[model samples]
Target: MLQVRVKPGIEDRIRGFFPWVYRAEIASLSRKPKKGELVVVRDFGGKFLGYGYINPDVSIAIRILSFDKEEPVTPELIKKRIREAYDYRKRLYINSNAFRLIHSEGDLLPGLIVDVYGEYAVLEFTTYGMNRFREVVLEALVETLRPKGIYEKANLTAQKVEGIKVREGPVYGEVPDEIVIWEHDLKYLINIPEGQKTGFFLDQRNARKFVRSLVEPGDRCLDVFCHTGGFALNMKKMGADEVIAVDISEPALEVGRKNEELNGLSGIEWVQANAFDYLRELDRRGEKFDVVVIDPPSFAKNKHAVPNALRGYKELCVRGLRITRQGGYLAIFSCSFHITEQHLLEVLTQASYDVRRQVRVIAKTFQDKDHPWILQMPNTLYLKGIWVEVV
Candidate 1:
């Protein structure tokens, strides 16, 4: 195994269990290191800090997997960690059969993600190091979940950034192109191969349920960026008189329509348009909704994009606030780690000031329990939403 030593000041964070070691923090290496090679990380003065995989070419040069000397990185360790992750998910007893089985670093399996949609499990290996453990991962997933099929979804970032060559589609048993899964009295039709983020946004399960509390039988609701109508369906299920779901993708809108039909739901107007443009149009028309949800895709993939991402968020928040009825509820979510809870609050405050709509936060939601995030890595807590009542 390759050995790496970090600069003096970098040892504390590594000792505190922060998994990543940036390329610049590295002071010395035992030898010329290869990408995706297992490496033991040490602090200055030659003290062992942790064990991880070294990816010399990436900005995040190393991702630690084990801090204990006895618990070195191995295929068996991957299997055991996976089983532990499954046991934890089972303990959650999430209302939905579908859940995030392994949340990459959240599960201490840095660089791997596994989402279970009923009988099918979708796996994404986001790092070359984790990809090397694919065989063991698959074997463990099978033994633990006993899913009808296991699908390997190729991640674009993994290919371009980590240089991880991947194979898409089913790697075990048989997987169908489409599958129907139920969550909290709502059934969603998932296009496994085609849908975004492993066919569904399981992270918002709690927020979807929480929205039901704010919706009344005769109130109107809007779900912007409503992929497959997760919030729209839940709003309608709560007896909202009218629901409008908007998204940029026509195929997603089509799926939203089917999902509505799948659940014996009707009257939800699915609109194929950009959510930003749609929200502006709604505000222009003076259309008001009793409940509104703006769940946009990550606008910031990296830290450099945070400023522009905040602008996008502010615009969305402004429009979301404008179209929401007085005393009604509005929730704006940012799925980017670059945009923190404070950033969201600040954006909302600015939007509120601009729109002249005094707001009071009713709730703040994070990714559901299935997608656990660790305190050591704030990036793991990517999905955040603020539910405010427009005053």
Candidate 2:
């Protein structure tokens, strides 16, 4: 394997279990290395740091998989990590079969994601280094899950950054276009082939269940960016009389409708439209709801986009607050790692001030336990939801 040494003082973080090494941090390389090559990283004094895979072209040059010298990156290690991740998920007691089996760095398998829905598993490789282990990953998934089929969802950003070529389709066996999965007495149809982020946003499972607690029988509820009617269905199931779900994607709205029928749920109004515009129109029409959920897609893909993302979130908070009846509940979520929980709280405060509405926070939720995050890497703890009551 090629050997690389980092600049003085850079090894401290690696020692602290920070998995990423930037290209600029490297001081010396044993040789000109190829992308996705296995490498041994060392400190300036030739002290062993970790074993990782290198991508010379990217900003994040190395993703260390093992810090122990005894444990090196190998096909067997990959399979063991997959099996261990499976064991962890099995103990989580997650309400649904659909869950994130591997959360990339969260599972110590950098650049790889695996989500299972019923008997099917969906995989995504976000780094060329991890993509090189595609065959091993598929083999491990088959061994551990014995699923009927496995599908691969292409991450466009990863393809662009890591120079990986991929097509979205089945990698093994036959995967159907849609599969039904149950969560807490609710049934949902997952379209693994075309749906966003590996068919469903399993990270929000806990939040979806928690939102039901705030809904009351015959209450009016609004679900913005209601992909597949997750929050909408829960509200209706909780006996809310009127539930309005809005999303920009007609296909997602269609799925939401199907999910409603699958759960034998009625009185859910599925609206296919831009959530921002729809919320404004609702305000103009003097529409108000007893409960409101604003769960938008990630507005910031990177740190550079955080300012605009905060602006978007503030607008959503302002609109969400305006349309919520006094003493009613409202929840706003941010799925972007760039948008911190502090940022959400600050934005909510400013929006509340601007709207002249006093609000009290009720609860806050993060990604469910199935998707564990490392303490060293805060980015792993993505997806934050803030629930408040308008006073």
Candidate 3:
């Protein structure tokens, strides 16, 4: 393998298992390394640091996979990591068959994501280096899950940045367009070929269940960006008399409708409109709800977008706080790593000040146990929700 050396002081983070080696950190290379090629990473003085794949063209040039000298990147090692990830998930007692089986760096397999739904598994390769192990990943997934089918999803940003080909669709066996999965007494229809983030937001499983605690029977509730009715249906299950689910995607709303009926639920008003617009309209109409959930998609894809994302989140928080009835509950979430929990709290404080409503934080929830995050990699803890009670 080609050996690569890092600049002085750069090896400290790598030794601390930071995983990523930036292009500017490299001091010398044994040869002109090809993109997506396995290489040995070393300290400035030639001591071995770790084993990783090199992507010479990108800013984050290398993603270290194995820190052990004996554990090089191999098919067997990949399979072992997959098995270990599975074992960890098994111990999670996630209360649902649908979950994230492999969380990339969290599972020590950067650039790879695997989500299991019923008997089907969805895979996404977000790095060129990891894409090279597709065959091994698929083989391991099949051998471990023995699922009826497997599907592949594309990460468009990764494709462009890592120079990997984007191939989305069924990769193995027979995968139906939709599959049904259960979560905490609720059944949802997952559109594997079309839904967002591997057919469902499994990371929000705990948050969805947690929302039920603040709901009371016959209460009025609003679910913004309520894709597939995860929150809306749960509100109804909690005996909320009136529930409104809003989303811009007509297709997602259609699935939300199906999910409602699948759970023998009725009376959830599914609205096909932009959540921002709908929230404003609700405010204009003097609407008040006992509970409100504003779970928007990632508003910031990169650090450069954080300012605009915070603006968007602040607007949502303002509207969410206004529409929530006195003594009621409101929950706001950010799925972007760039939007920290502190950002949400800061935005909420400003929103509350502007709206003149005193608020008390009720709870804070994060990605479920199945989607474990590395402490060193804050980005791995990408999802955060803040639940508050309006006073």
Candidate 4:
């Protein structure tokens, strides 16, 4: 394998078990390896460090595959990582048919995501290295788990960053047009063939369950960005009096409405419109509700756009407060990794102050157990949500 030398202080960071090697950390390279090539990582003094996957184009130049200097990045190593990640889910009692199996760097497998829905598992290979191991990983999962279906959903911008086109459908077994899965005793119709992010936001499973618990009998709820009605269906099951589900995509709304029926539910108010525009219009008309949910998509992808994202979140919160009855509840969230907990809280605080409403946080939540957060990595805990009661 080609050997790469790191700068003086960077070797310590790499030795300290940081999984990423930035291009700036490298002082010199003993060999020019191709993108996604397996390379030997070494210290500035030529001492062996570890093995990693190298990509010349990305700032995260090398994603460490093994920290052991002698260990090879083999299929066995991949299997071990997969089993370790699966064991964590098993320990958490999240044997649910639908859950995130691998969360990129969180699972020590950078640029890869796996979501298991019952007998079917969807694999998203985002990075060049992970993409290269797609077949091996799929074979290992099928062999070890005996899953009925193993499909691929590499339709993410991260794949584009690696100069890879989104490849959807079955890598093995049969691919379904709409994959159905269960969460918290709720049935959801997920179109992995057409839906977003492995077909649904399984990361918000626990938070939606929390929402279900908050609903009282005969209470009216509004779910904004109610894609596939995950939150809407939960509210319905909890016996909410009425639910107004809104989304920009008519197709998503159709699937969501079907999910409602799949769960044997009715009396949902479904509207297809721009969420921001709809919220603002509702605020202007002085329409109010007992409960409201704001679970918008990530407004900012990187740090540079966090300010704008915060502004957008603040506006959403303010409008949500405007359309909420006094002593009512609003579940607000931001999925952007660039937005910190402190930042989100501060934005909410400012929104409450501007609206002159007293808001108290009833609860705080992150992604479910399926998405593990590494101690040294805060990015894994990207989704921040708060149950705010307007007073």
RMSD to native for every prediction? 1.0, 0.8, 0.9, 1.6
How many residue pairs clash in all the candidates, one count each?
Answer: 0, 0, 0, 0
Lowest lDDT sum, 10 consecutive residues, model 3, at: 371-380
Error of 4 at 39 (Å): 1.8
Measured by TM-score, how close is model 4 to the native structure? 0.96
From the highest lDDT down, the ranking of the candidates is: 2, 3, 1, 4
lDDT by residue (tens digit), candidate 3, 1-391: 9999999999888888999999999999999999899999999999999999999989999999999999999999999999999998888888998999999999999999999999999999999999999999999999999999999998898889998998998999999998999998999999988898899999999999999998899999999999989999999999999999999999999999989888899999999998888999999999999999999999998999999999999999999999999999999999999999999999999999999999999899999898888888888899999999998
Q: After superposition, which runs of candidate 2 have C-alpha atoms over 4 Å from their true positions? A: none
Report the Cα lDDT for residue 165, model 3.
95
Work out the TM-score per prediction: 0.98, 0.99, 0.99, 0.96
Query: lDDT tens digits, residues 172-261, model 1?
Result: 999999999989888988898999989999999999999999999999999999988999999999999999999998988899999999
Better by TM-score, candidate 4 or 3: 3
Residue range 269-310, candidate 2, lDDT tens digits: 999998999999999998999999999999998999999999
10 residues in a row with least lDDT, candidate 4: 155-164
Residue 273 lDDT in candidate 1? 92
Candidate 2 accuracy as TM-score: 0.99
- In candidate 3, which residue ranges exceed 4 Å CA deviation? none
What Cα-based lDDT does every candidate model obtain? 0.93, 0.95, 0.94, 0.85
